[model samples]
Target: MNNIEFIRNEEKKYHDFCYENYKLFEEGSWLYKPVKTVMDLLPLFDNNESLNVIDLGCGVGRNSIPIAEAIKNKNGKVVCVDLLDSALNKLKEYSKQYKVEKVIRTEKADIGNYKIKPNEFDFIIAVSALEHVKSEEVFEEVVRQMPEGTKNNGVNCLIINSEVQEIDLETNEKLDVLMELNLSIEVMMNKLSSIYTGWEVLKTVVNPLEYNITRSEKPVLLKTNAITYVVRKSIG
Candidate 1:
């Protein structure tokens, strides 16, 4: 299958299945929890009342719910964007359940095509989302826009998967990696550096992880280098 087809299929299979069967933060599920790193960096903006944040590929408000809860008193807003109707629907339901509906907004759009408004956000996060973009160029463009979309003293947190290697468990042989834009570690780092120059780099980490899963009805082991980058836009 081609790139777009592969992406759609993967999205339908993984995202649809996961969001359908598993409750957010359900025990033993991949969606068991939100990224702690994202949670950790939130306090940096604590002093900013009226917070505005963007969560690209926010699935079912795992992180967005907590974010809304944190900033609700401050009149904070978290714009949760995803391509799936089901995801957005669940997010809305959960926001009301958590009593943070007033602080949450949902947008249905593919993150690749979703434009970030200039200086419109206090914080922007895309966790394991940008890799699914159509191409490396698209990825770079999105990364370039991240800082531009942030207000001064605001932050951008990105957790991207790079250098994916899928292995067939039974045969012990490598299989075709299915992500749309499987960028190399070097390339990913270089682009972030070039685009986010002069920003206060808070964190840069590369964690290698392995997961066993059934894909296309076959048991496979997926390996990836998860890159986490957090930076702040210095006030001029």
Candidate 2:
């Protein structure tokens, strides 16, 4: 296969993997918790004014629900975008359960194809999402657009799996490896700093994690090097 085809195949495999295991994102599952990185940025929003938020790859309203609750009284709304219909439906249900349904909207779309309108959102989040894009070009394009997609002084938070190695937790057999950036942490940080020049970078962290998964009724662990970027656009 050519490079484009290889990338497409990999993207499809990842999507199919998530779709097949959609049950793991059910409301009661461990995957249904809000991300701490996203939560920590909540206090930065203007409490007296309504805000428009967009969450890319917002699976099952894990982060979306909490955001909705945070902004519900402020006349804020959250636009949730994801690839899976099942996941979006669950988000809708969870929104109602949390009584934030009025302020939550769901859209089903692949993040790779989803376009962000300029100056459209007050807060934008892409947690564990953008790394799945098919190519470096697409990834860079998405990152480049994020600043323009936000309103002046708007905030954007992103958490991505930069590199990972999958292993069986029981036998410790190496299963698979995925490196979205394939660049070292230092290089990645430099690239981000260069990209967001003139913008305020609140936090940049590289966190290594051991994520647990189940394959063939066996526990598997993914050793991941994740990176987070929290940035705010300046009113210019």
Candidate 3:
């Protein structure tokens, strides 16, 4: 299936609530807090080097526009990568309207198979967009392709579904599947770090969380919002 199909399938079946709650996540709402939390990590941007940031699986520019606004004054720029044309088109228009167009460059492509420079980015963000990636191998591949040391001293932010948890159902008292929507960060450092020791190249990893309790208390099992780690990434 194509990216849109992939996304729609996930949203409709697993995360329809997040999609339906998009308006609140759009600008200034409680749901938008997570996006804001993601941008707050930008303080790590030293701005000494040419700022090259990447927004992986950027959906409609929620986090992209905010990052662009924050770094527009500096010699910084953002590259938003996504698999959906609909999201890219909307990001284009929003960047223009927000007056950060000059600082934002968007690309329509799949992260699972895209050819990106190794360690080229000063920052890489994957906000609320990992569950859709599905396979651990694919997820690792995306990281493997990252410009290795190019992100030296850089930060990579990620939001994904944490390990599944069990919830007791009121009806039958049987345990049900529940997961925490997680917010995590990975940093790229020079020397080795504890939080990062996966593929020789990753520097460090970071995690900061802000979650929304699913509004519905229906019989359906619901997941929680959780922020998992804080680490670094470096290339081999």
* Local distance difference test values of all predictions, in order: 0.89, 0.79, 0.58
Better of 2 and 3 by TM-score: 2
- Evaluated at residue 232, the lDDT of candidate 1 is 96
Query: What would the C-alpha RMSD of candidate 1 be, to one decimal place?
Result: 1.3
* Candidate with more favorable, higher TM-score: 1 or 3: 1
Model 1 lDDT at residue 201: 97
Tens-place lDDT per residue, model 3, 1-236, is 85546545544443444434454245643335346556667776654546778888776677878888888878788889887665677678778888999999988776676667875777777765554554555655565555352466666665554443334445534343332122222222221233245633322333433333332344433343433333445443
Per-residue lDDT, model 3, residue 67, is: 81
Q: How far is candidate 3 from the true structure (C-alpha RMSD, Å)?
A: 6.3
| Per-residue lDDT over 50-70 for candidate 2, one digit per residue giving the tens place of the 0 to 100 score | 799999988778789888988
Off by over 4 Å in 2: 1-32, 178-183
Order of quality (lDDT): 1, 2, 3
- Give stretches of model 1 more than 4 Å off: none
lDDT of 2: 0.79
Question: Which clashing pairs does model 2 show?
Answer: none
lDDT by residue (tens digit), candidate 1, 13-81: 877777888898788566788889999988898788689999999989888988888899987899999
Pick the TM-score winner.
Answer: 1
